[model samples]
Target: MAPIFSLFLVLITEFSLATAQQRNSNISLGSSLSPASSNSFWSSGSGQFAFGFYPNGDGFSIGIWYATIAPKTVIWTAKRDDPPFHRDSKLLLGNDGRLILQQGEDPEKTIAGGSQIGSSASMLDTGNFVLYNSRSEIIWQSFDAPTDTLLPGQKLRQFEEPNELFSSVSKDDHSTGKFRILMQEDGYLAQYPADSPNLVEYGYWDSGIKIAGNNVTLNLDDNGQLYLLNNSDNMKNLYDGGNVSDKLMYRMTLDADGIFKVYSYGLNRSDDDWKVEWSPNSVHKCDPKGVCGQNQYCILMNQEALDNVVWFNDPYSILSNTSRPDCEDECLKDYDCEVVLHKDDQCMKQRLPLKFGRQQNDPVITLVKVGGREFKKEKQSKVLIASVVVLIVAFTVLAISGVLIYKYRVKGYKKLLNSGNEELIEDVILRSFTYGELEQATNGFAEELGKGATGTVFKGLISNGKRVVAVKRLETVVAEGEREFRNEMKVIGRTHHKNLVKLLGYCNDRTNRLLVYEFISNGSLADVLFKSETKPRWEERVRIAVNVARGILYLHEECETQIIHRDIKPQNILLDERHCAKIADFGLSKLMNLNQTRTNTGVRGTRGYVAPEWHMNLPVTVKADVFSFGILFLEIICCRRSLDPDLAEAEVILVDWVFDCFDSHELDKLVQDEKVDKSKLERMVRLGIWCIQDDPSLRPSMKKVVLMLEGTVDIPTPPSPSSFLSSI
Candidate 1:
């Protein structure tokens, strides 16, 4: 029995040792991975990081990401700018030592190519994926081709060619974004917009080390210290993270907003993760050039005396004879002028694509020219006499025509009566329903769906229950309600878009006015976003946001007559059975002719969603609707109300809290524990901020907003939107 026990123990020990060896073994040549395979990824020995297929959009992408993280964070990607590969694609390390990707019998694409051949690969614990030769020497490594992140023990070296780290387009997109950090040949590290020339004027940040003929490298140590090292072995500390605990992981990243930051996360904790440990503070918040695009200037707030001033470089034309007031008039009059700088009775005019704007202590008054319409004054006496004559002639003609039409209608009615048929008033454009028919359809207004400022909505079935409809019974039959009913009918009746609610017919009988619309089955967006037991998926919210934007775009630009949806909120958006969003509630909308751009009007939206221009008595335009949609967009992203008094004091106002989180690099607070596409989330947040700008000119048109939401255009960094709120 003792001999048998010894043999059993030996055999168990050998088996355990063999298993351990296999677990730690390097990936051999000819190994492959596919999305459908059970072994889809090659993980590091500690199972902290992996290299293989990752879910991207509706397909798969070859990348390296943290395997243990709750929301898997990708650090490196192959073919970063290419569209995601299909599910049938495969990644293979060929026997000849080439890493290749094959998609459905297509030609193999080389992922990592080099002169060295016949090697193995490994997904190292340092978050680096490496290919090694027969001598165990690294031939190619992902660390050498960094994307947007630098893990601990990684180095960015400036050798024969300058090393650059481009920011990702968004949290979800690994493609190169707008900004990049370059380790210059002159031993100075600088940040610039990716599209701009790598010149000093384009650089937004620099390490200030300009020594030439020295090898420079940026390194991140395991202790959370980031530093620059030169050939003399001299180290310049960029950020000292104060020796982070072993239970924490650190990463240095150039964020999508063009802010370089060092982040830390606790390994043991799940919530409240990704804290910003270090970010540059030596420069002003708005020091980054190209943040605002051509013809735009950035406003920096909460600055010292010297920082309050704004300056533009290289004005195309300077007029020494112009006065300060004349400077503004000059820019406004000249269609080519974009901005004007005036000082000591001299006006300097800048043309389109203003460049190199900065803030400094100076006495120059900068006036920016935005778009506006000019109204020519007419002679009052001539206009009044002409109007009176036209009215007298029109009244006489209308009276004659009215009598003739009435006599013909009366004769026709008598003929119909003689024929035993009821007289019917037919409208070619809109079907006119009688009050009795609507009442019968709604079963005497028995089932109430909702109540709004104008009227109450009732759910009903018509055509013997074959068709469902919503009937909005107007409460005020007098001047105000009558005007709203007519306006809504005229505005929505002619507009046609999939995202806009369909107006079936209307009832305008005696003192009753009702609007009949096709029934939306899913309810209001507010109910789905705020009141539902389970929050809608992120994809759904994004789709709803785009749908709402398209609806507003159609109202603002695509329709025959431009319309301003004075009230655009979650409650005004209805969803159908497939969760497709459609914009409703047009009672407060305003119409504008093709020649008109803006109008002065009273505030007409919900309190929390109203644009700042309403309170300031400024001219309202389609931008007002844009501002309201901005508020609604934020609500959709965060799945919270714009104003919630039940939350903490700092978070009570959703816009303020969202901006604070965005400013502080703590956007995780906006969607705690929820898995979201970080890139799209940030893009939406930036767009919302831009839409809510205090200055109406800063708000983008709904057309551009749709383009940005659809990822067809880039969204610029936004300024503080709380200026009006703070003043109030």
Candidate 2:
């Protein structure tokens, strides 16, 4: 009887143990805080965040979104790159204490993997999804890895260490986009294009200015402003926000168009509502990246400077002058550019260079939203300053002297010709030829090398190779052009500078005018600077910069008529086989008595290369040429075009950007091209900045510009240049 009773007790205990094992098998505990089911994953008790195989976009993923708030928003994602193959994908704990995402029935078919060491998945009150192991060790936490949306305590950078950044989601799709927010080597927290290894470089401030040691806290105030706080004391305000203190939550994101936005949330809101906050892009279409070509500046379309209010001009664009018809053609050649013309006003902008590094030349300020919709056409309240003017977006004005020369040469106004009044050239030799002779000799002008403002330059062998010369033909003859043609010949014929293109002979036939010059086999400097096929290397670039400086010096000081190559830009600078720069395009050239301080005239010269004083109706002097030379110098140092679209956001117009670095003594930042040698490059950047001082009296003379290029003259530190006012 006793043996039977013992057997009965053993059976009951076995039955109870079997039932408990069955229920436990269906559920697993990689963490004891909350057990995970075969079909469902659990979030820690705080309810601030949740992670599960949630439905998003077209598929599902183990994603974390805010659960405590009314509106759910995904803040962190584990498998953002690839989604689950099917709806049966499960998140479960393994016997080996690992968190694995298994597809369908196969538990080993891992879709995602996480260390189960501390494998308890919990949600912090700060909306952070943290996964820890049993020993109280954090294995993977959402705070350390952030997506596009940034939380209050999360940092946009890893201090001291550079280039560390967070990823943002592409539009609609949960996939990561090609933009990142990171700290640059130059000590600025920069938003970089995915393909661009350098900063997407919207603008930079002094991020290197150290705050109060390790106890510093980065605070995103209620307004969109981002601040660095040392303990309880404010150290530095990193971002410039007008109302960053009004909101309860703030998040900054890299938008789809590569623009960065700072968004703010109302009280106790889950996802923050955002406004423009700040955008690096222009409000007026006129000041587009490439609207006025290589040397032109874009004027603002609207007079007002406010956010969300776009200036109105038909087609939303404008030009600085209406003289250069070729400006349109030059603008179209840029890769990431688009042109819009309205009522004679033209605007060009970057076409959202989807490929990274392509839009570096045209930076736009993109503002994104976390809770609200992306910025689209909407009614924005703005204070109207004044009546809307018929603002100009694009126009190309010819030089005043050039225009005068045209008027004086008109057929009906023969008295203003000034044909024989040669003020600069002493002994004038004149030769006339019929159209037939020129056409026959050069094979119908078929041996054409290139064209300039004056006319086409054809390669011709005169006297059956007695001398091979370049014949330049002036196609159009304006009423006042006769005097300009005469002045041009006098200036080049008498000037014997090695840096200037030499004039050999001349031909004038009523409407047709031709000048013979020494033939240069190599092409214009524009080709070498822009076209990669003929791109000049570091050594070649330095030599070209030095050679051009010498030529400017000759025009300003040594020439019989102190000449200003008014249209001084890469396109106007021609290169010889040895890569020596020769100053060309004297059509816009100005002549002044030697050592004269000023000459008043309408603004001339290419856009980006023109000096700021020229815009102020000030006297054109050697300092103007110095400003141009400074632009060219930096172009050579960076191995990029002057007024490049890439540096647009940094507001890096040639002189201003260089002077900023010079004032800071951050010379190494100018060597943008990785291929260039560092030691040699810094010297060139320093020299270039010195040549472009704002005060005309403060600028170095061309004689000094040449000496600095030659590594002989020591350059004093340059003062900060005035910020370039946006023209578009």
Candidate 3:
């Protein structure tokens, strides 16, 4: 009778949970949270805090903050450093006992997480979202990784290990800004600009320094006094807030102007406003230099005539002293640089929407740059802004994107001109060619190089007949394709990477979209790896990896605007005569500009090479490319494809299979050539694993990845490849 009653109770509990999930009104595991979902947010039982995604800048951030506040005061972001743009993002309390933030339908990026055992997560009244273990003990808490705001029970610390402890988020965009409060090596709390990974201090107080311990921890209480607990043992007064009411909530926030302050919340009544409680020393009083980025000077503001050259013109730019049109033309060429100023031959440019006011003013007259967004729109507006073009979502048996190219140039623009649009013609950097000219070069489509569903390629000779190029003729036009073409033209026109394929020029007519590229004699990496009997030497493989890493780093860090390459695989890696890697296909990163069209329609990547984040629907960052590179690295060295179902004895999955070799200490077996340097091979293996760590934070930046390959830095042993479940 007791067993029967227990079964009945279990049925009731299951039914209740099922009902709650189906209603889409509660926060729980298996619940889908989205901007479009009705149950997008989860509030604590007391209704003091909420956990969900919110609009931030041009993107969105999954965060936890005060529920009752206007404009939403965010305290913690799952990925404070990397937020997802407007797209498909999801949050999950996984059955594996972890909390995951998914971006753009990619499940691989677990942006933030806790223990992955028998743990459960919940939003508590204390404004802490936490994960609990089997015994209900808190295993991990959001209070530990505070971004800009500090609630009552949170603590900020600095470890003896060199690391950036806390950084403030931008007040406008909610992105990581310049302001930072870090625990110095001497145990003095100081503020610095978050420009680099290494700590650079702006100011520090010597009186409160505590150099005795290995680490220092600090926290704020409900009463508003900030205190330091050295070694978590000795308590010391850092800031004494006299007679603060306990009923009001006090928060310490770092403002966008690079200042730290304390604010007390309103009383029980609605009319009370927040009051300032405490602040840092005199360092934050003035507008700090270096906060306004480089290539600009800082001076005291006076009452007289002053022009902020950086603010009025642009931030980083160049110019030549020719004519007013030429000077402004230089500034207008910059994608985002808006303002232009010129005097004599010294043309100066800057970006508007300045962060700080400058005291010094230049006499140069600043004018809105020509060829600006307005000018571009006016020029493009002449061309027919066609209705949204539809594309068929279909796939064939062969490649992820079956499109390939051959060398040819078409006199395509002549055809557009012949269409009776003479006044619409304008001088552009990328030239247009006629279809007859291309047909003459390609020998009337005689040489069929490659064919895909959407495009076809042919081999062709230039009018000079000295050099050859690859000509790809796109068959259809889609909204995404239009965006991709524009992005590709804008990016490759200015970018010059030794490891990146050069875009020679392109032709744009209504139906046909053709692109010309420098032809390479050798085929893609896939063709060589799969067809050739002799494998590429180990040294060559290492060089290719480093070269590819350099190109990726340039796009992510070195470039003015960050570029995230959604697809990275061997097929897209073109090989030159020297066996060097040149990343082909602008379609890779350009597609990232558009939100995922349909979950099942678009090709995220080739099946095995796609990162887990894409599958889980998480924020796609530069790390997505790193994950693919890791797979490529292993594939190149191990002489095996990522997934080969035909293999016997169940050795198909490359990452899992290689890690199995690492566990057995048979990593040396990866190499085919005995002449390969053992130390270099070992470094490559370790670095590859490091790049593919399950957590995005665990993956090293491309800069560090290059240094490790160059033997400038030590490579630590990598954790196991993050396939949650597998068997040999």
Candidate 4:
């Protein structure tokens, strides 16, 4: 009797806790919940859906999944690329209306944000997490952002032939997979290789709908029917499942096996839970468009015979080619290449025993001779041993040198103090902190903010909740890394403009190189300008443009040492609470004596925004930065990215399109924001055209640019910009 009573009590307690999760549907601002605590999730009113962390890899990913089963099926994830690094993680709704994910006592990352003040978050009974503004309007919702899975009532919009969705790495692995259902430029939705977007459009499963317009929606109904909603409000059935019990919930998912499927399931969770209702492609495992081994073909006997394939001990990565969008070029450019196995543009070069399969087909294989010699792998073990020995010796040397460097740095600072130069000492110490202090402030570096080629940034709180700062950790601390570190330090020490983000402090202890800066409530300019559903007002656009020009003007002139910002683009420009622009990321900035006009250097800036001189290898100057700013200026007015894929053939390049609009007397079409004053808008466009001229001699200086934007200088009739159409 005692044992029975105890079991009953345990079941009752678990039920009560689960019930509480549904009733308390709110996650308040500045607070976080973690799955490791057993109460980190909130359930829908009927307990049908739940939002929490799903454990995978070294850490867990924050996702919304079905809660009634043993193995949860994730419907959506906040950050597919950046997942929480620990079990003791929490999801926080910040005061600024951003959805932040943080690992236990670690740095925090902003996964999603609501662009409204006084907004609050609620996990709705319909499995939607919404951020509601003060007027009770939804500022942001989880439904607007979909991952690999799509639930009933959710819609995928195709305003401009949108292609967005990725597959899970494997049946058990939730990382990136090679398959995707994408919308091609030819008005079709098909399953293609995720890594290759520009290959000839081919897929095993396509919607087969040839529509006349781009405004359409792909949605699933409660009865397990997939339909397309055109510009009209009518639904056209694409795939029908006849009839299923209305009680069963259905979901469409892009699985790891490169198959898109719709499955039906219900509560109680039977052994064979998910019932497949619809599959566009054949159910055979080989029918799905999966990646295959390089230069290898299967006999296609049966599933059992699939295992009778060869593999290599040392398999390289997806041998990617930087010159082209697809992998074909990478295989051909390599010295040791013998065969290029290509499928949807994804290539695998075969040198050793072939690797990979479950890739849908025997790839379109192409073979080529390298130096007219055959390939062989021998003495591999000896090669690995020698590599390890060299690495160990190199690390030892770096460690010894690091210690000597640290002593000199500390000694030099002490000398300033001993010499009684209080100003110099104060300046150095004011922007200095021990590595441990930053580590503690960031809770063991748990939350990642953003990552770039050079370093990764994390969100941090200091002064006991008073200050929020962004902390950047460089990938390495040697050679190029050291140069970037000192360059930033020198540039930041001299400049203090209102449009420049202030550097709070820095950490340089041994191999660790970190920087701390004030956190602007609003994020990057690229973030605001590139959103598919939202656009900035004309007034805000002009303000941001003028303010950014002012910041650049200050760097070029008003400083004690003239600083040339070599990289000036939307991502490097940040916005503050007032929506004012601030130029950040000074790692690429160069200092010159007041009279120096230009200097020679290698290519540096991003692909789309780099100056034309980069291609010619001419002496780089401040005009290079001016050229980038001009491109960004055009992007702001048009409300389009520099790399837009939705334009007609004639308007393929943004700069070329602008010129076409000017020549055709279709300036009205060039200005998208209706509220913009036409004369001012045309003047702005003309200024942008002049700033991006091919001849550095023709492009206006930054000082004159500020005057032109302010309506102080007389505007000039701009000529056509030199043709520069290079792909990234």
Candidate 4 RMSD computed on C-alpha atoms after optimal superposition onto the true structure: 25.7
TM-score of candidate 3 against the unseen true structure: 0.43
Q: Which stretches of candidate 4 lie over 4 Å from their true place?
A: 1-23, 104-106, 160-163, 184-186, 201-204, 242-246, 268-272, 282-290, 293-337, 340-372, 375-728
Report lDDT (Cα) of residue 186, candidate 3. 42
Worst 10 residues of 4 by lDDT: 397-406
**Residue-wise lDDT of candidate 1 within 1-728, one digit each (tens)?**
99999999999998896666446648898999999888789988778899999999999889998888868888888889879999988899988787888886444677874447857988888998888889988888888788888899888877532277888887888888878887765456778887664544456787754433357888887777988888888888888765555557889888765778888877665574688888888654455655444433343433323222343355657787787667777777777676566676777776544443444444565455544322111111101111111111111101110000112213321321222211111111456689999899899999999998778999987644546789998784444565566666776777767798877778888688888887998899999989998887666688899999999999888776778888899999999865899999763446677677666656677888888888877777888899899999999989999889899999988889999998997787788887665666788899999998889899999999999988999998899886565444
Ranked by TM-score from best down, the candidates are 1, 4, 3, 2
| Candidate 2 runs further than 4 Å off | 1-435, 475-478, 481-488, 595-597, 646-648, 651-669, 673-679, 725-728
Q: Point to the candidate with the largest lDDT.
A: 1
Per-residue lDDT of candidate 2, residues 1-728 (tens digit)? 99999999999998887665434322244432112334444454444456666565656656666665445556666657664345655555555445665554432332222434443445555656655566756666666666665666665443332124334444445557655556432223444444332311212112334343334444454455676655447557767666434544556655543455565546443544334555444223332222222212222334432221121111213344432333344345443233322112223222221111111121222211112222221122322211332232221221000001111112311221134212111122333346666666577888888876657889876543434667778764444566776766666677666677777567656677777776676778777777765455555677788888888888877766777777777877887654578887653345677667666657777777778788877777878888878877777776567666666666456556666666666656665534444445566776666666667788888898778777787766565655552361
TM-score of each: 0.46, 0.39, 0.43, 0.46
Residue 467: error of model 1 in Å?
A: 79
Deviation in Å, model 2, residue 621 alpha carbon: 0.9
lDDT of 2 at 684: 73
Cα misplacement distance, residue 383 of candidate 4 (Å): 26
Model 1 spans with C-alpha error above 4 angstroms: 1-25, 105-107, 208-213, 244-247, 270-272, 283-285, 295-314, 319-338, 344-346, 355-728
Report RMSD (Å) for each prediction in the order shown.
27.4, 27.6, 24.5, 25.7
TM-score of predicted structure 4:
0.46
TM value for model 2: 0.39
